[model samples]
Target: MTVPPADNPARFLGRADAYAAARPGYPAALGAWLEEAGLLSGGVADIGAGTGLFTALLLRAGARVAAVEPNPEMRAHLEASLDGAVRAGQLSVHAGTSEATGLPGGSAGLITAAQAAHWFDPARTVPEFRRVLRPGGRVLLVWNDWRAAQTPFNRAYGEVVRAHTGDDPLRVRVLEDELPQHLPGGFERHTFTHDHPLTREGLRALATSVSYLPNQGDPAYPAMARGLDAAFDAHERGGQVALAYQTQAFLGCLD
Candidate 1:
């Protein structure tokens, strides 16, 4: 399958299923912290809320949420999965991006971008966030940093992914830069350990959900599968392998 160009906003169009199935959610502890910090009050705009992974968490915490996503396919999944919340007036889904949220000025007290800040152009995103946010509103940037720790399984899994990684320009898996610099003043950083328990098939789906990595139909998928299978075999216990991640978060207000 031909990969979509890196600039294509709908690049994730077809991978929504795998992504929704395999991607991990933010830690419950993190949500509790946000509540304790009073960040989740007044309502939230979950920008780049792909498939509503983080959006669901916000809803659970009793925050009135507006989920904004650009890709129809991914947004469809989110809407479908959270239709109950929509009907109950707990959630609203919008088709938008960080640079252009399509939300009213001062509509939200908080804005969040989970596993999506790397794709945002902070110049526009920061201003857009500021517009939608109420006075002194905060923005939360979250990512499951898979490379934050060096572990046996992580090293082997990294090798498997790197082996077949082509010149896929859309492969912006990690945020090389921090978002706090753009969100001057009011900033605090925190991290929590998290893990996803995956069976062999779940492991494959997790890797396939990565657009840069080889998918099920890609030519390199066979080798990728074998490599990942081996990694799982080496690390699996009780019929599952625990994939480790550091749930890193940056909470700050735009100046």
Candidate 2:
């Protein structure tokens, strides 16, 4: 997968709704892992916190969360989604990127980028993350990757995406290969299986939510939608299909 240009907010423009609605939240086991590892002992910073998906998880785990996101549309959705938490003083939304989080130095015990690390320029963001984290603080990178080989529908869907997008650097699996160079101190890896049940419409939204995929106006979009429909029809039972995912977490600290 080829990496897209950094700071390309246009990729996500106008797609915040689909992204918020279709994206799978992290598994509860992630919170349990954080607790066990002592990463949540203080405030947390969730960088690239699109639509508050992972931010909600951090808040639910009783941590004061600062959700740093650069895209206005995505950030609006995040703020709206976590309005209750904001009013209660549990979560704060910031207009910032991974490289420039606007967080005070050494203020966070843990910094996380859930499904967003690929957008960052590690040269800058890694050092910035280290700056914001207190001593012994951890950085957790997470993704809910499609288990493409798990079922016929999953395999077909994978083919469709690759056919249209060519090489999608945003694919979660690529992170595992690239992260080590950025965090050379090494990371502790963990994986858990999760499934999201989706209706045909929900499946379509999920397909389009990916940033690298062709959008509605693209010449290939109709075929993309058709592929997703076919996958849904083949796998769906009782009006829903189970989309399998391998939720991966990589935990480490800067030297």
Candidate 3:
């Protein structure tokens, strides 16, 4: 597998609001899955926790959360998103990257990276995860993969992304394919379906929130926007579109 450059943090700079508003959240079933696997009882370190999306879910599942985010803007958005939980001591936000979480040894019983692991250098990050997790602690990697084949709108939107950002090397890889190769121990995987409702504006936000895509001021952005608009007009129903996702989770323990 190819390793992309470590420039994702910079790519997301100044786009925290769009990310928080547009990105889909993990399903509640994830929390249930954790509990069923007997891994929900202690401290959880949510690495690369952007805008507190998965962090919020972990907190609600009755875990003390340490949200480690490298990007300052995204960290601020995360802090804002979980203010009440922070005040209540349910969560803490740290400025840290996946390869250097700055957490104490054996501090977490569970570690997680939701929609963020592709940016990490596994050579560094896998060991860091091992350092922070207690004995028998597990790591979970999660992603909401857009199922383009599920709907015509999805297929069209995917084409738009590919047309504009195909040259970009950044891509979300399957955790099942990469985690076992890099993690100290092999992992197991599970998947579930999730759906998000989007209006035309929501669709626009989704497109702009993608880090690899050209932003509003970029020369190629107008065409991207037109593509998204065209897709929306063709498939929208009752002023909304359904974006289907295959939510994948991979779990493993470190050596």
Q: For model 2, what is the error of residue 13's alpha carbon versus the real structure, in angstroms, after optimal superposition?
A: 0.5
Error of 2 at 194 (Å): 0.5
- Report the C-alpha displacement of residue 157, candidate 3, in angstroms: 1.1
In terms of lDDT, which candidate is stronger, 1 or 2?
1
CA lDDT of each prediction against the hidden true structure: 0.82, 0.81, 0.83
Instruction: Single out the weakest 10-residue window by summed lDDT for candidate 1.
Output: 167-176
Candidate 2 — which pairs collide? none
Question: lDDT tens string, model 3, 14-118?
Answer: 678788898889899988878777787879999999988899889878889999998899999999879999999989999888888999999999999998888
Which lDDT tens digits does candidate 2 get at residues 1-255? 445435456778878888898888888988877777667878999998988889888887888998998889999999898899999998889988888899999989989888887777777788898899998888888888885337766786787777786656455544567777556678888988888888888887887788778777878889999988887788778999877888888888677
Best by TM-score: 3
Error of 1 at 157 (Å): 1.0
Error of 1 at 87 (Å): 0.9
Model 3 weakest 10-residue run by lDDT = 167-176
Candidate 2 TM-score, true structure as reference: 0.93
Measured with C-alpha atoms, the lDDT of residue 188 in candidate 1 is 75
RMSD of each: 3.1, 1.8, 1.9
**TM-score of every candidate:** 0.91, 0.93, 0.94
Ranking by lDDT: 3, 1, 2
